[model samples]
Target: MDIFVVDDERIIAETLAIILRNHGYSAETFFSAEHALASIGKSPRLLLTDFRMGRMSGIDLAMEAHSRIDCSVILFSSDLQECDREWQMLQKRDSRCTLLRKPLHPARLLQQVRLSLSTEPRLGLHVS
Candidate 1:
């Protein structure tokens, strides 16, 4: 998979995936982090996941994906404060994670995706 768009909200997840697909990239949608985790690691892929979700938060999934496949992650949430608190624990020089707020524009999402995939190592936490 080129990218995994995960969110508890079905519409958001699918819509993001569709947008990515329309942009000429492979994309998949998962309604829960667990489902996405189960399907990952055949190869490293980028992840665009909602920060808060069932069973596991996006940060939790990102940590696991990094450990398993060194995947890049883009975590989004309406709850900015909570996302920030959780993300602070994971920031490091070699980390490849980005945080975005909700109501994300399609242009911005595409921009982030390009940026995330264009680079290999991403240091610090990129928030927008």
Candidate 2:
């Protein structure tokens, strides 16, 4: 698969996955970080997830996924300002990940996905 779209909100995850699929990319939806992690037998190229979720934070999942597989991560939050601590930890620990502040613009999301699929990974907090 090309990507795994995870969010605590099932509808959001499903919708994102569908959008990516409609754009000719392979994608899957997971309602929680744990479920995404559990299903990563053969990790997809990218993991797009929500920053806050039950039981596990997105950073924790990203770290764990990076440890187990070679995939990039994109974490989204309604307010990036409130997630400074988590964001800092993630930035210090990894460069193949990005934080996208919510109300994501579909075009920007697709652009980032394309850029992420390139030979190199990009690291900048994208607020689209």
Model 2: weakest 10-residue lDDT segment is 119-128
* TM-scores, one per candidate: 0.91, 0.94
Candidate 2 wrong stretches, greater than 4 Å? 126-128
- Scored by lDDT, the top model is 2
Candidate 1 has which clashing residue pairs, if any? none
Candidate 1 RMSD computed on C-alpha atoms after optimal superposition onto the true structure: 1.6
Candidate 1 residue-wise lDDT, 10-119, digit = tens = 99998898899999999988899999889886554688899899889888888888778867788898878866767887775236788888888999989888888885
lDDT agreement with native, every candidate: 0.83, 0.86
After superposition, the stretches of candidate 1 with alpha carbons farther than 4 Å from their true spots are none
Q: Model 2, 4-61: lDDT tens per residue? A: 9999999899889988999999998998899999998867999999999999888889
Clashes (N, CA, C under 3 Å) per candidate: 0, 0
